[model samples]
Target: MHTTTKTSPIETKDLVQKTVFPILFSISFAHLLNDLIQAIIPSVYPILKENYHLSFSEIGLITFAFQLTASLFQPFVGYYTDKYPQPFSQIYGMLFSLAGIIALSFADNFYMILISVMLIGTGSSIFHPESARVSYLASGGKRGLAQSIFQVGGNFGTALGPLLVALIVVPNSQKYILWFIIAAIIGLGIISKIAFWYRDHLVLRTNQKKEIVAYHDLSKGKVNWAIAILLIVIFSKFFYSACLSTYYTFYVIDKFHLTIKQAQFHMFIYLIAYAAGTILGGPLGDKIGRKYVIWFSVFGATPFALLLPYVSLFWTDVLMVVIGIIISSAFPAILVYAQELLPKKLGMVSGLFYGFAFGMGALGSAFLGKLADVTSIQYVYQVCSFLPIIGAICYFLPNLKKK
Candidate 1:
């Protein structure tokens, strides 16, 4: 009995470490590469606008196509993979992005640019749902921290995108985006290896309910209602994010008369703060409870965001960093809370939230773009400043974490 007990504990420990970190970090690195490629789109928008003689509405349409493609396919992909897991599918998704990047490099007109981004968007749709499920499977009950680790990678890549644009893509022609093809290739290789790990550890999938199942007794109606509220929080978060990602550079340029590179750098400041927040939100949720993190991340940003449209150039930069950090923290908490709400449907829940976030971002960018055209980019910021007020929805979310 003594020998058996000792062996079992040792075996379990070995299994836990092997299934969790190695796979999580590998998948996280893949996310980094994937998002870097995605970030390139917004980073190069100034050039796209100039090359295409695009209207603000047209620039918004580019995001519309990309986000629609990214959003619509995610839930379907998540649902299918939940039934029949596809470990290598991510590599294929990356290849599609590679094709899109190549086409985008030479895209002479608006339609071609749309096609290129749609393909990249398809890659994101395929990548996120599956990767998120894998993260959950490998989490070993540290869902929040694992998710944050996974997110930080993508956030890091996102932070890099604008910096790359400022240093490389801004001075060069459209063809410079082709440099990211190398990142896609590296991602494909990493995800291929991750497929092997996922296949090897498919046995671990059975334990997914261990953490959340105790609290899962809530009615399906409650789950749906909670999900609806969570969706609103996501809408507020990503829509505000879209205003920054899609239009902040233009806003800076118009208001401060900054050069394109200078505006891109300011955008990078916002994104890096966002990346930092992404890294912290997950782990903080794990420790202090997802609910508190949700409330803090969402409502906490309100004052900062509200101040942004009214601040001076120096304060604008400072307030955006505060807004980015506070606001972006909400996502990790929100996603983990939703996952626990419907523990059985991790893939579906993740896909829906991720998809909804993408959809909101697209819709906001397009809607705000038209608004900017009608009013002004500065007015759009002022309008979006109030989005965090919707975080009151968090007050309604049930705390799934048992005391």
Candidate 2:
């Protein structure tokens, strides 16, 4: 008699609807669009190079333009988004990104492409801070899960970008630029509507109403260890980004002698693994501890990265996928760790983590590219393997106790 009634299982679908799904969906969609814009360029780089007779260094420079702009502006964007209540900043950022894509459609020379890439970077830069701030605020107790969802969106975008370009542009390469413009216009419409609706319904506290914390307050001695850890994370990210930017494309082409389309498909495997890792990593980090999760992830990636150059095409692809997953898993943990490191100054800490780390990584692309120029691309891959080892060492550094 006391056994009585059973409560209906909390409908997973219903819970998702009520909780974090919308935020995840919105951020994911935005990330997907942003990544798609960048993804197209790399996928079709071969075409661009052939058409324009561009050098490897020139191609590297073009890619740098996109990342440099995004990296440099990250702190400024993160600061203001945290301070400002208006959603229009994010919306306008999307609009500017679309404009950059549209401009790319008409680009006939390196300068024009550079301008377009810069515009796209400017637009893309705004999303991370604003979307991250929104996701964090919306997350309530489940910040790790929420961040994972946001990150998955980005991973999906990264995965899909090259695939999309391969499918659309590989056959009729001349039409690729036009397709980018069309996609931009469509994405802009969708983002504009959603942003306006979000602004209308959501009421936010003003900057005056919010308590302010200075950077110096958060950057004291206790947090220096955390900063050092984050620097290691940055180094790892640099290697990761460098590989994603250059080696992923080149490796497949060089090792297998595959066509652009074939190479892109293989790249998809790496991205798919990466996306899965990013999605799963955050929740796992919460379950265990962020520090432990990061340490394991960094350590796990090292073997796969080191072995990547020695394997055949099929096995190398498999190792790359595994490497992607391992690396991706560490990022959310790193982000959360940085946030915890400076609880009072979330915005500033986030700004430094997102801006400086990524910007420095973007700068690393040039360094890696030069290394590729001097030695071989395989050496670049081998050099990248050391980053995680360094990260692992930093993570285990006994003096750096978590505050």
Candidate 3:
């Protein structure tokens, strides 16, 4: 819903045009809670595979189902919220996540688990676009830093998932997943507060804060072409990520004969570095401009990624961290760039990019899993190592810097 205040741009600048740190941190913490719950699904894949006597292809399907559901709905959600602006949508999203996690805890068969994850994915679809819009609304002129604060929470939560699953779910039992209900309860409360903030802020803020005039100078065909190029960059980034996040644990376990728990620790280390990289990405984008960060973040990781497949275990751990940090920086920069590219369509842009990123990741995980079944997980890593080279297309993007 578009709320037109009588407040002029100059007046709005004085009254509400400053970054609201309280709102930013609160919503970001809620994002952390939401992703923490979502990450648990992949984090426990080993347990699911072992308990169900499933094949690698089944693991891929599970990811496909979850990510597909998550990705397909986001643009719709974002587009709707852009017009309708449902402040309490976050609460509803968390409630769905709660239900899905609870169902997942007791799921007995493959189909049931898939259905449960779909519900969880639905929750994510709703949560991300809405939270991202709120982050945009709260940005005040520091969109990059605000997005960084919001995104780092999610990466941190993602890093914690496998670590927590290893400590609690693996040693105890599958039912331990129910304990995350506590996280959901806390999330509900947090989102409720955020919803209140969103409701209050909606009327005060302008509909589209940042103007994307650069793309306007180009023809519509050129704008779409640039967007397609960015999507390719996203595909490269998330697909490579799918190879690592979903398969790295299995890879280390098979190669080094390390226990699953040990492998998860290495994944956690990679994810922690990933979180650190995300924090730096947005602020750097603000200071240096998104093009440089976007280009460097993805391709910059190439050397480490190439080295990873041939490395020893200790070196593997070190390389994974380096790769994680560099690759993880791409998203925040990529996202804010897309939002700027289509400033009037902020929700649509956010949803489309976020949705496509998840969808590509799903395809990557499923396709790589099938490839692993045909060849080997080690070979999958070797193949995916070349994805970052796709970042070279970043050279084709026009400079978006203002004169």
Tell me, by lDDT, which candidate is best: 3
The root-mean-square deviation over C-alpha atoms between each candidate and the true structure, in angstroms, is 3.6, 7.0, 3.3
- Give TM-scores for every candidate, taking all chains together and pairing residue i with residue i: 0.94, 0.86, 0.94
Model 2 is weakest, by summed lDDT over 10 consecutive residues, at 205-214
Candidate 1 residue-wise lDDT, 20-60, digit = tens: 78888998899999999999888888889987789999999
Model 1 spans with C-alpha error above 4 angstroms? 1-19, 204-215
RMSD in Å for model 3: 3.3
Query: Per-residue alpha-carbon lDDT of model 3 for 81-164, expressed as tens digits?
Result: 878889998888888899999999999999999998999989999999989988887888677888999999999989988999
Off by over 4 Å in 2: 1-18, 193-219, 394-403
Clashes of 2: 0
Clash list (residue pairs), candidate 1: none
> To one decimal, what is the Cα RMSD in angstroms of model 1 from the true structure?
3.6
Measured on C-alpha atoms, candidate 2 has an lDDT of 0.69
Q: Candidate 2 — which pairs collide?
A: none
Q: Rank the candidates by lDDT, best first.
A: 3, 1, 2
